[model samples]
Target chain A: MSEAVSALNGQSFVGIVKIEEAGPQGMITLRGDAGAAALQKAARDVAGVDMPGIRGIAAAGDRAIAWMSPDEWLILLPHAQAHEGVATLRTALAGTHHLAENVSDARALFRVTGEPARLREVLAKLAPADLHPDRFGTGEMRRTRLAQVPAAIWLDSAGEARVICFRSVASYVFDLLSVAAAPGSEVGFFDA
Target chain B: MLILECPCCGVLADETELAPGGEAHLKRFGPGASDDEFEGYLFMRENPRGVHFERWRHVNGCGKWFHAARDTSTLEVFGTYPAQTTEPPRDIRDRISARRPGWTWREFA
Candidate 1:
């Protein structure tokens, strides 16, 4: 068992390790009934776009990205745009077979921008989502279990990737990543 | 262990998640209906020796109830779709329609 330690800030905790990997500037999760055609139509009408298909991700302008599912989806956006994006989706899906629950604060986002292969190796340890090019290619998204946590994962066209895990387990997953990175010794946190 | 496939959730789910809807193509008889209608409704069996359609619920998985067409003899799954969706791949729609004339083929096709 690892010894419990306190950080420089004097916060004592168990298994709360610092993540040296890049971190997302922002992220959000949206859950609801994706099968409702009326809700989908409303979302398109309000967001001026339709949600992406399963194993796919679509960006709504420069502000948000909506990932699809059989009965739910997660919408990711910049921190600054989170509130407005949720508001728009809510108003659009009103009075329909839909329920959009905001879970931005519930999840912690991690951004990986350097050493793609190394980052992939670290992620493979805890992610059940297929990260293969054929399956998850650039701009694709998947909702899968990671480190026993439900997560949404996606990669931008630029090859930068983002992974979101529930806040409750973020510290544990961060520790796991830190250990995985120890082998390659390329761990570092993002400035942003 | 009868391997049942679910429409909403793909194959490979526990049978416990499903509640047997009994041999597919059930006919219902009302008070004004005839004796033949009641008998057919109570105990009629195509006893399809080959392929048959079975309704199943993906309770433990997607929780969406749906139907599947499969071969009882060979256990070859034809296809599956959402409940009330008019598109099942195999010709089970024709078989179901042929057995009951008044039944709406469009309803469960």
Candidate 2:
């Protein structure tokens, strides 16, 4: 196997908030009914996190699960364990008609951190999602278009968010974040 | 600035977040279909000025396909529903009826 490197080699840019490429992270895109109890159990057993409800995400330590759509859920775990995670899920859901794929290498992950309102401002400028503190808070996930690319935004904490987009668009997203986070561009709409 | 609700995830997404999928409830015509029917299915669309039903993909959100009923001119959304149904639900049809007074989904030519 070829040597593994993150999409951006841990590129970091600072402006209104710190924008950095996340370390190698494992992601499994499970195409199945997220509402199914069997699927939920399999997800929880693998990630040690509950299968999140629609637009919700639950995480425990380095493992996490998020609802990407009514029929799909995303499982996040340590990079080294991704393949094994797919094997375990496939075995657990043997009779089910489902698709589980290791999407870790197919996507890029990044983090934006400062504070809730600051983080919201950086992301809300690009995504159509309402990032108002009252509307989108921690644990909520939105799969929306960030600029011209399809991306998913997870409000992980009051001061941080996880942004994931296709590997090819890493620079595009990184640049967008950098420009949005420029010091003078702060639009504290949510700070009110 | 048209906002549509995704019945699959129940998210009210902006039109920019959703992809318009032409017309909804289309009866696909295959190899054995008549030429006019196939052409109608492929090329024709109802240009209703009032109530209309159309397909929309919540491409940015849930990534699911859903159907929406709305007014073409005024942009008053009647309702949205899962794309699995072949016809509009009774409630949505009723809502459109109440809103437009005499609107009925026109039959395909």
Candidate 3:
């Protein structure tokens, strides 16, 4: 294994919202016919979890999967398991019209948790998707732009948002989130 | 800022999240067609004052391409539909007719 450090290694920001890298997680991009039973079985056999439905996420132990588009899903797993996971999936899906790429190095992930209302305000400024819990609660995922950069966002069970952006723009996303989470920077409705 | 709902994902995508795809339901004039036919298909577009149909892609959302019907003058959206069909859906046509009386665009009257 190559010794590749994370983009924000040894760096973390804290304020009303705490921002930090989610460690080294494996990411895989899965694309296929969602309704096909064979694809579903293969995904479950390889990832140890059912593929998530539209705008939904399914978590099984250490692995989690998020629905990105109609026929696309993002699978997150332990770094050590990514390689084996991809090979297993490829074999399982042999002769099928599908693609399973190991995107572990393509994306950077951050976990953001804080005052719900404050976090909502910050996300609203960057993304157009409604961050209100009623609209974007747990299990729901969206592929949207954050500050002109493409990202995938979703809330965990604890209401903490997991923001994933391309590795190339990881630093920019981190800085933008830090600025938004800074003290006294959160613009309340009355202030707006 | 115009917001068009993506029929596939049901997301009300903002103009920034969506990419405009010019006119919708256009027929192609390929080989064996007259020069005028090909030219018309390639360049000519219906720039109406009201009740226009166009294509849009939810670039930052579901990444699905869809169609939207709206009035060019007022910016009032009639509705959005899937891109699989060759023309706008019946329900969207009815909605446009209800809003703009006696408007004619394509086969919809």
Which model scores highest in DockQ?
2
Top-lDDT candidate index: 2
For candidate 2, lDDT tens digit of each residue in B1-109?
7998788877779999999998889889999999999998899888888888999999888888999999999999999998999888889988887778878666621
lDDT for each residue of candidate 1 in B1-109, tens digit (9 for 90 to 100): 4555554534344455456565554656889999998998888765565556667765433456677776667766655556774356446556544554443332354
Stretches off by above 4 angstroms in model 2 are none
Interface root-mean-square deviation of model 2 in angstroms is: 0.9
Expressed as tens digits, the lDDT of each residue in A1-192 for candidate 1 is 233221111212221122332333334445567777776775565445577765566776644445534665566555455567667767776776566655655666665554555555555555643454554557666545555555556676533666666667777655655665564454333212
The residue pairs found clashing in candidate 1 are: A20-A188
DockQ, all candidates in order: 0.07, 0.83, 0.69
Give the DockQ (C-alpha) for candidate 2. 0.83
Clashing pairs in 3: none
Error of 2 at B54 (Å): 0.3
Instruction: Give the per-residue lDDT digits (tens) of candidate 3, residues A1-192.
Output: 886566676357887678787767798888999887878887888668888777888888888888888888888888778889889888988998889999878888898887676767767778877776667778888888998888888877543788898889999999888887888786773122
lDDT string for model 2 (A1-192, tens) is 666799899999999899999978999988887567788888889999888788889999999998898888899999999999999999999998788999999999999988678888999999988878778888888889998999999877898899999999999999999999998888878786
